[model samples]
Target: MRAAIAGSDAVRGTTSPNPPVGCVILDAEGNQVGLGATQPPGGSHAEVMALVDAGTKARGGTAVVTLEPCAHHGRTPPCTRALIAAGVKKVVFAVADPNPAAAGGRTVLTDAGVTVESGLLADEVELGPLRAWLHYARTGRPHVTWKYAATLDGRVAAADGTSRWISSEESRAQVHDLRRRIDAIVAGRGTILADDSALTARSADGTADGTSVDRQPLRVVVGTGDLPEGARVLDDAAETLHLRTREPSEVLAALGERGVVDVLLEGGPTLAGAFVQAGAVDRVLAYVAPTLLGDGPVALGASGVSTITGAHRFRVEGVTMCGPDVRISAVPDRN
Candidate 1:
């Protein structure tokens, strides 16, 4: 199951609308035979790929998958049918398929006399690779992760408005890797005007030369202001979209229409505050440097929290050291 989860994580950015599932096949003697992850859209699912890899070895074998094998026919045939045809005898899955159309795979397998078991490392799978997709399935919107880097005093920029290189090199590399795994990178027009950021996910070693990776997430700029013709985001590094709207929900809706499942909000403090005020932020990824800047722009602008009771609180999910910086992951605390 852990291997399956890792496989799922490996292909997170490629599959959208379709869950990025992972599967491993073990022969009758319990020796691992094959492993695979979901392909891009309109491609074979994870089980089919793994079965193809297993070939004749799949007969009477056990299949361990990150997500329940989908049982419905969408872009391709149902995965349950493929598993049955592969002659797999037992299936162990971490998380059940949440889509109404994709659910009931266990039943299908059981009806075919295949042993089916679920909830093996379910929480890990759900909270790890499946987190954004599950949220998109339950809600008809993209999952938003607001990302920001600031000093220990919560200052995103210095007093002179210079905000370059706040986080350590390791943290920046992690951010670039994260940018490669999501559907889109969202920022406001103000950020584009001020930073002139390319917003492209570049190779870890090519950051100095500005060489982008093979797969770059969609760059989305939101706001009514006009972007300069020479803006770096307008280059050919990746696809760029000008939303021409300041509403966070509207931006998300537009991206959702484009089949975006995960979003990294990289906008400035004002834009971040707007999303916060609209209650649209789903997760928060903060990178805090050890240094402190007493006078500078904070991480967030006016967020409509007039009273202390109205503060938007969040539960810290994790804290880790990224070189000299501290990285924190948190989600909103609605309770």
Candidate 2:
């Protein structure tokens, strides 16, 4: 199941705007029979592709999938029907679908007398194919990741405004890796004005790699403010939107309405403060340089969540050292 589930990560960057999905099939003897993962956009689903490969053998077997087999019709016919036709005796799933049209697919199966189970590999499934979709289901919004590269002391740039690379090549490559999975990347006026970034998800080769080509994420700059004369961000503004505003939640809501399933925030401290304070930052990825800048800057500044009760608190999730840079990740505490 873990090997089958891990396959979903390959399709995450391509599946976004669409949901991430994965599938596995078992033989009557309960041995692994066939497996398929969603390919880039316009590719066949894991179940459909697996069934295609499994042929007549899929009958009388169990299908283990990361998500509830989608019931409502879309690019393909309902998965529940497909599984039934394939004679999959049982279905095991990690998470329930929240789409109103497809929400009851599991019930449909169980009612048909097929052995159905939910939440079997829920955590692993979430970390795999259903990750982004599960995030949307839980919060009515996609999982948001805020990333920043700060100086030795954590300053993004000196108050004097000399902003070049703070972290090493390894750390920068890691940032590009994060860019691949997100539906879009956001920044405030200050970030755009100071650093004109070409926020596209480029490969380590510095060339465009568009597996799910049309999945090009909207490059969002949040402000109607004029940009520098030769600002790179403005050059690509046609693929983005600039909304002058102070309300972070409103901006997030607007983006959500536009089919932005997930967002990556590449910013300095101010916007991070706003997002974290609003209870909007689901995760923080910070890359800390080993050297010290004395009083330069830090990854996080003063948070803006109201009162101690409203403060943004996180439980450390991971710590990784890449060269001289130490990467730390934190998740919002449910409490």
Candidate 3:
């Protein structure tokens, strides 16, 4: 299970909206026969790749996959059919499909006389692979992961608003890769005006056209305020999606209806806080640098809690170092 889940990290930035899954097939002697991962939305599925690698060796073997085999056909054939054809005799998994069409993989396998066991390291497996999908299934909108850069003391910028290079080049490249996976990237009016961010989903080859290929994530800005005339997002008039909403749920719901399944919020403090306070934030990814900027914009919007005694709590999900900075992620307690 650990190996299956670990394989998901290799394709994080490209899998957006789609949950990343990993699979491993082992023969009777417990020697690995095949290994694979979910490619993209409509590409080869994890089990197909693993079965392909396993080939004829898959017969009578055990297949351990991080997520349940998908039961229905969509971009690819149903994975249950692949496993059965490959002759995998037993299956073990960490999660079940919540999608209506995919809800009965284990049932189908059981009816076919295959043994199945589930929930081995389920939480960790889900976090690594099914995070975006689970978040979307629960809220009916794209999973929103608010990404930001801040000082060690949690300042996003100085009092003068001269924020630059909070993290290293390596980290910025990593962020861009994140840009490619999601259906859209959003910013507040302030970020759009101040940064003049293109808000386009850029990749190594070129920028998304917002039409042909996933519609370029619908470049979005939230505001009632006006943006500068020369801003890049404004320059491409037909390409931008502007939402004038004071409420988070209203805007998110509209986006969800359009098939947007994941959103990366690279917006300003007020907007980020609005999302968090509204219980709209699904994940928080912050890059904390080593220096302290003191009285600048804090990592989050200012709220009066009167001390540590008064606070809204969230759980730390994971932490990793990017160049000289540390990235911290958290999820709200569903309990």
- Candidate 3 lDDT, 6-80, residue by residue in tens: 776555545545667889999867889999888877788888988998989989998999888988888789999
The lDDT of model 1 is 0.91
Regions more than 4 Å wrong, model 2: 30-33, 39-44, 127-129, 203-216, 228-230, 235-238, 305-310
TM agreement with the true structure for every prediction = 0.97, 0.86, 0.81
Q: How far off is model 2, as Cα RMSD?
A: 3.1
Worst 10 residues of 3 by lDDT: 204-213
What tens digits encode model 1's per-residue C-alpha lDDT throughout 1-335?
Answer: 88889999999989997778899999999988989999999999999999999999999999999999988999999999999999999999998887898998999999999999999999998889999999998898899999999999999999999987888888888998999899999998898998898998875443633544568899999989789998999998799999999888899899899899999999799999999999889999999999988998998988999999889999999999999999999999978
Candidate with more favorable, higher lDDT: 1 or 3: 1
Error of 3 at 61 (Å): 1.8
Q: What is the lDDT for 237 in model 3?
A: 32
Candidate 3 runs further than 4 Å off = 13-17, 169-174, 200-218, 224-230, 234-240, 302-310, 319-323
- Tell me the lDDT of candidate 3: 0.78
RMSD of each: 1.4, 3.1, 4.4
